[model samples]
Target chain A: MASPEIEELTQALSRLPGLGPRSARRAVLHLLKKRESALEPLLRALDAVNERLVTCSLCGNVDTVDPCGICADPRRDARALCVVEDVADLWALDKSRLFPGRFHVLGGRLSALEGVRPEDLSIDALVARVEAGGIDEVVLAMNATLEGQTTAHYLAERLERFPVRLTQLAHGVPVGGELDYLDEGTLAQALRARRPLG
Target chain B: MASPEIEELTQALSRLPGLGPRSARRAVLHLLKKRESALEPLLRALDAVNERLVTCSLCGNVDTVDPCGICADPRRDARALCVVEDVADLWALDKSRLFPGRFHVLGGRLSALEGVRPEDLSIDALVARVEAGGIDEVVLAMNATLEGQTTAHYLAERLERFPVRLTQLAHGVPVGGELDYLDEGTLAQALRARRPLG
Candidate 1:
């Protein structure tokens, strides 16, 4: 019932991660209604990102620059490298500001179900980075999912020959998590890795 | 931790309906990963819609051409005018193919809380269209909500002087609705407007 351009716009929007057909239509309507405030800004932003954005050759992270801001920053701890399944995970970890290190995006996890292998990821590059030598620690910051853990374990074996220390994120109850709501595996991990009081 | 362009893109996406900050970030990452297939197509589609889309001066419906497809269509019943609160509603109604007529978008409902008056909508233009003649029926296809009903009532009053038959959508149970799950208001409406068996 809408114009072809509007329908096409809605179809494109629905392909995004969070938006479905219904929501995409609503979003398109909203954009059409507020062309100056919403549509134009979004268009400009998308255009800018599309024109300027580039993948970091060193770590596989996407940014406006070749090496990315994180990789080029002199203040970040180059010795501590964080390996992640995807750029989104890298962004999430970096947003915390707790890991004062650079990142290596694996591009994807080792998914046996989907037939994703180590060869498909940037595993060779990660090993080469560790072997080339300034890195003292390699944090495998993959998600706690089965595939993520499997990838981390595989990476550990590959990087074990190197002089760098290998580690993964600890499994525990979340900060504001209720004990009753906590799952068995998490509670067990949290209890088993109990820390000493200051 | 993302680049400024990427950050701007995420912020713009988050402003869209049904998309929040986290989802927007995920969407941006998805776009970055699939630049060729997803991002480029979306950009092209948005650009096309932005550049070519125009609102129909007569009815406020948006299209690639002036007067819109519905308003310009020779096959459509020009004598039957479907009045809607928004273009989205117009599209929805038209999608059903039940309303074989042209439409007039009121822009928004008459919401006293939001300070939206009749003057703010396309009510004056609607009245002018009716006064110009040839319209036999004016279907007030507003939503069943309080505000929608109020807007329909206001439009009915304004168009009462015209020879056109002013009508509204029936208030009752939906096509596949169950009595157990239905609200009291809907149930009462369904009972009041119940039709005899064939």
Candidate 2:
């Protein structure tokens, strides 16, 4: 029988994205075997992250300090705000190494089908911040999913009254992304959303 | 520019199985966003596992203390032994809820191609323990890989000199393992290894 402690470790590891019971077991076994090499470093990193980490009060992103380095920086464009559904979306945009403005993370998209409503999102804060007048542009950098579109449209409607330019992400096809690799809907939408200059 | 701290965190996360730069970024972002609810718990679990965990000095399996509960327990068969390549192998055997005797982890299999020799393993200790004479049988339960087979054969030959019974794990379709579902190689192996019961 597996010890309760080992079981707990496995369960905890399984909670990570893409990790299942089998993979979790394999990972734990690997960790146990290389306890000094991998596990100790992992443990130390975990503790360090936990003890020092905080959140960006403005964008709801994780950081080691409140407001985060991005939000606190004086040189960043306070006038340009990129709105994304989740912190993943924010990181995706950041990886482009193009955007120089601040971000607003909504945590998740509006999904009436899933009962996620407008009020459940951080849209109110975004609207208030937009009305505060420093923001000149608001880019909806959400995933091109059904819910993502719904949320973007909803936010667009709300921001119509506020004085801010709106835009969306456009560029090369993702590096490892494929057409057959993409679903029918996403492929069709990507084609339809194709722009000139590329 | 991203902070060195954030970069370091991302690098550490990248080392985890299946996590690359993109996945690592997403995970770090998620951890930051759910700092209190998810990240803190993960950090605590990692810390606790590292600080409190130990390995069984005798069997080399991970545990909360040296010798492990299994090795320290008075009821387990100290006389009979089961040999395996990795601690994971031992855990898998344990999961069967069978195998009453204690275990001996060889750390890994012997592979001339990989420069692994018997002397590189715990073979010396295993031989000494077997020679001490209480052991009636030693089961060679190493993996079914080529290296594992070689290790098993070598150990069997070495231990043949001692006054102890030695045997290898039966080669056949695994229990809950199907023939048609088996790959061509495994199917061929199952056929080749067929035996008649007396």
TM-scores of the candidates are: 0.95, 0.88
Model 1 chain B: ten consecutive residues of lowest lDDT: B63-72
Candidate 2 lDDT (Cα, 0 to 1): 0.78
TM-score of 2: 0.88
Query: Which stretches of model 1 miss by more than 4 angstroms?
Result: none
Which window of 10 residues has the lowest lDDT sum in candidate 2 chain A? A167-176
Docking class of 1: high
- Over A15-37, each residue of candidate 1 has an lDDT whose tens digit, in order, gives 99999999999999999999999
How good is model 1 by TM-score? Answer: 0.95
Question: Best lDDT goes to which candidate?
Answer: 1
Q: Indicate which candidate wins on DockQ.
A: 1
List per-prediction Cα lDDT, in the order shown: 0.94, 0.78
* Native interface contact recovery, all models: 0.91, 0.29
